[model samples]
Target: MSALLDIRQLHAFYGKSHVLHGVDLHVGAGEIVSLLGRNGVGRSTLVKAAMGQVAARGAVRFKGADILGLKAYQIAHRGLGYVPESRDVFPTLTVEQNLLLGRKRNADTGRWRLGDMYRMFPRLEERRGVAAGLLSGGEQQMLTLCRTLMGDPDLMMIDEPTEGLAPQVVAPVARYLLALRERGIAVLLVEQKLAIALDISQRVYVMGRGAIVFEGTPEQLRQDGGVRREWLEV
Candidate 1:
């Protein structure tokens, strides 16, 4: 798998408070790489910076082009999708309407369609007529994930996708992510659930104090308890 999104010596800040240190990470084409850590370790910040939602940077290259200084929408149009920790859904819109908003106008429908999203998470199809705000937390999450996919992004950076879901809800979300991988979409997942991340990802990166502390295959990470205790464990 070749590199799809690459960051080298990346640093990010929020106003006066510096957050991410010089971090280095990459996600390969059609691969799933989970970014794991405890809360406030700058896991979200890293993805935000890469998506051009934050300030400061070193190198953020996606598909061999320098995407630094571009706006979020600009980066998104280039095939890098970002779903923030906040499930940003239009409350007033119907589930299908929200998904329609994500469709790129005048562009070739790449990989995702309304049917694809609905097929992946059948609950979305059932609730297509409902307003987004009326849905539960898990349902909103499903809507958000599918909405982003409707844009047909090649690489999606998802932040804390399973944050507040029940176990039953989480299982399908995990399975949907696997389904995305099968469809040749690379995922940069910011995940709090270590088990799901390890189970689905080919590789995992452990973040500590705004920097990458460990990067290895899931099996390698499973064998290394010290890295987990220092960077990931509660």
Candidate 2:
């Protein structure tokens, strides 16, 4: 598979404090790659840097072109979508309205459509007229994911997608991500849950002290208890 998003020697800083240190990773077309680490290890920072959400330096190439210095919106317009950990949906806007905001102008048509999002999560369709702020946590998370998809991105970086979701709801989210992969969309998922990451990702990168310590397939990671104990296990 060809690389959809690539990062090499990535470094990011929050004000005076440095967070990410030479993090290198890649997501291939039609693949799901999970970034797993303990809190504060800069997993989220790496994705933020890729999206230009924070001050970052070094190579961030999307679809074989450098996008390191582009603004967040500029990156989005380049077919790189981001769903932040906070699930930044428009609170005042209705469900459909918030999704409409994600539609890119003059973008080359992609597989996802508004009707597809509604069909994927019928609950969203039910509350199409309801304000986003009034939706439940799981519903908001769904909205955020579907909203990003509306932009027809070739690659999506999502942070903590199941952070606050109920157990039953988590399965559907995982399935939906797999569906994205089936549709040839690459996913960079930053998640805290070991089971979900292990279950869904084609490959995994373990971060320790802001750098990747291990990169391998799920089976390889599962067989290495030392890496898990040092970087991932709480």
Candidate 3:
């Protein structure tokens, strides 16, 4: 069967600085695929290139359509969601308002709603009236994830979702991704936390210097310590 998201020989650049080098990756429907590597290996840039946030060359096919040159908003319109490492949120807006901003004009056709988000993270519901900026780091992260879900995406490329989060928030975030998978939403996770990623992901890819070096099941990744030591271990 064809993949939900397929990227082949992908190259990404920021100005003259070439970041990704002929990378190839794929994610299947309802699958959780994790991109793992240390910093500066172009993990973030891969997703950015796919999202059309940077200049890139190669084939990016989403749901059998070529999406390489599409604009970022256009990509999102195609049922593809992106949550950057920045956790970009409207600080001045109330938590509820921020979520409201994420709803597509016809979001009712999608599976998610404010009630679902509230149920997933009761803290967000409790602080629904509070400004997003005033919330804790973990709370802000939850808000960002929920906002993206409001768009009702078929596939989500989430970058560094667990970065800088407190220990207590990490497990819940993993569970959140698993829940998305259960709902048949494919996820391409750009994550640094190996334990969480390995635990939740169906497949894992290890990157080194902008190229994918290993791709296999989480068990294969765990058994191969050399890849972890050279590409993943801090």
Candidate 4:
């Protein structure tokens, strides 16, 4: 079977500084793949390049079509959802309103619904009418994830979904991601938390110096102390 997302020799730059150098990776349908690395190793850049959020060269193929030069919105319309490390929620909009904004044009289509989001995070339902700015950091993160799901993306590229949150809040995020996989939505997760990434992902890739240095099942990564020390351990 072909990959749902395929990237080959991807190179990205900001001004004249190159960030990603010949990075290659793939995500298969119904798979949860994590990109792991310490800071400044270009994990986020790889996802941004895949989403057309940065200037990049080389191939980014989605379901067999070249998507390298497409604009961000165009790429999104092609069923790829991006949840940045920074949780971006419209401050003034009500919780429900924020979710409504994420709905793709033909409302009745897609696998996810507002009710599904609420079911996944009951707090969102409780605060359905509250302004998004009033939500706590954890709540905002959940909102952002649900908002992206509201778009009904076939593949979600999430960057650091558990960056800053109480311990109680972290597990739910993992469960939600697992649920996405169970529902057959492919995920390309970019995460720094080793335990969470390893626990939830079927496969993992470790990045170093803007390139993929290792790829294997989670169990293999757990046993490779050398790679963990060089690329993941702080």
Candidate 5:
């Protein structure tokens, strides 16, 4: 099967500080892949480069086409959805309004809807009328995922979805990602939480110093103490 997103020898820069030194990665259709790395290793930068938020030099093929020179909005129009580490929800907007922003009914139809999202996260439904800024951190994260789903993206790149959330909240978010996979949506997840990534992803790529150092199944990652100690340990 062809990959939904394929990035080869990707190099990116933030002003003079060059990051993402020749990173190569891919996400196959309907598969959940995890990008695991420690802080400052450019995992987030990889996602940003894919989303075209930063200047990138390399080949980024989405659905078998080059996406290198496209703008961020162009990438989104091509059916890529991004949930940044910060959960980029509109603070002043109501929950319902925020979700509406992602709805592209004229485009492809996926299993994501306001009702479906609410079912996946009942808290969001309960707070539909409330302002997004007033919601708790966990609530905000859930809202972010739901809003992204409204866009009906074929491939979704999620950056650190479980970060700073309570364990109780993290479990449900992980389940939601699995559900997305069941619906045939490809997901590329960037996570610092090793267990969370292992629990949800079928394959894992460990990033060290802006490059992929290890690519294997979840069990392989668990059995390698050297990888765990070097790349994952705090």
Candidate 6:
């Protein structure tokens, strides 16, 4: 079967500084893949390049068509959702309103719904009328996930969902991602937290200096301490 998303020799630049060099990756249908890397390794740049949020020179195929030069909104319209590391949520909008903004009316109708989001994140339902800025970090993270789910994306590229959260908080988020995989949504996560990524992803790709250096099952990644130390251990 063809990949749900395919990127070949993807190259990206920020002004004149090249960030991604000949990066290649793919995500299959209903698969959970994680990109592991330390800071400033172009993981986030890969995500932006895939979503057309950055200028890139490479082939980015989503679903079936080439999406290299598409606008960010166009990419989102094509059933791709992105949750950046910053967790871009409207500070003044109420919790419900923030989620409503994520609703893509033109998207394919699937299992995702406001009720599903509410069930997945009970905190959102509880603070339906509260301002988004008032929520805690974990709550905001949950809200960010819910907001992306609202778009009903077939594929989601999430960057660092557990960056600043406590271990207890990361656990539930990991569980939520696994639940998403069960529901048949392809997730491509860029994460620094190796344990969380390994626990939730079916496959892993270790990236360094803007290129993918290793790809394997989670168990293979764990057993190779040398590779881990070189690319992941901080």
TM for every model, in the order presented, reads 0.97, 0.97, 0.98, 0.98, 0.97, 0.96
Task: State the lDDT of candidate 1 residue by residue for 1-234, as single tens digits.
Answer: 669999999989999888999999999999999999999999999999998889977999999999989999999999999998899999999999999999864436467778888888899899999999999999999999988888888999999999999998999999989999999999999999999999999999999998899999999999999998888887
Write down the lDDT of every candidate, Cα atoms only. 0.92, 0.91, 0.93, 0.93, 0.91, 0.90
lDDT of 2 by residue, 1-234 (tens): 777888999999999999988888999988999999998999889988898888999899999999998899999998998999998889999999999888885435557777899888989999999999999999999999999999989989999999989998898899889989888888999999999899989999999998999999999999999999888877
lDDT of 5 at 115: 89
| Candidate 6 per-residue lDDT over residues 1-234, each given as its tens digit | 569999999999999999999999999988999999889999999999898888899899999999899999999988898999998889899999998899886535556777888887777899989999999898899999989888888999999999999777887788789888988999999988887888888899999999999999999999999999999887
Q: Residues 1-234, candidate 3, lDDT per residue (tens digit)? A: 469999999999999999999999999999999999999999999999999998999999999999999899999989899999888889999999999899874865779989989988889999999999999989999999999999999999999999999898988888899889989999999998899888989999989999999999999999998999999988
Please report, as a residue range, the 10-residue window in candidate 6 with the lowest summed lDDT.
105-114
Query: Which residue pairs come into collision in candidate 4?
Result: none
User: Which residue segments of model 2 deviate by more than 4 Å?
Assistant: 105-108
The Cα RMSD of model 6 versus the native structure comes to 1.4
Ranking by lDDT: 4, 3, 1, 5, 2, 6
Q: Give stretches of model 5 more than 4 Å off.
A: 107-110
On a 0 to 100 scale, what is the lDDT of residue 175 in model 2? 86
Model 3: ten consecutive residues of lowest lDDT: 101-110
What is the C-alpha local distance difference test score of candidate 3? 0.93
- Model 5, position 30, has a per-residue lDDT of 95
* 81: Cα error in model 4, Å: 0.5
Question: Which runs of model 3 end up more than 4 angstroms from their true locations?
Answer: none
List of clashing residue pairs for candidate 6: none
Candidate 5 lDDT (Cα, 0 to 1): 0.91
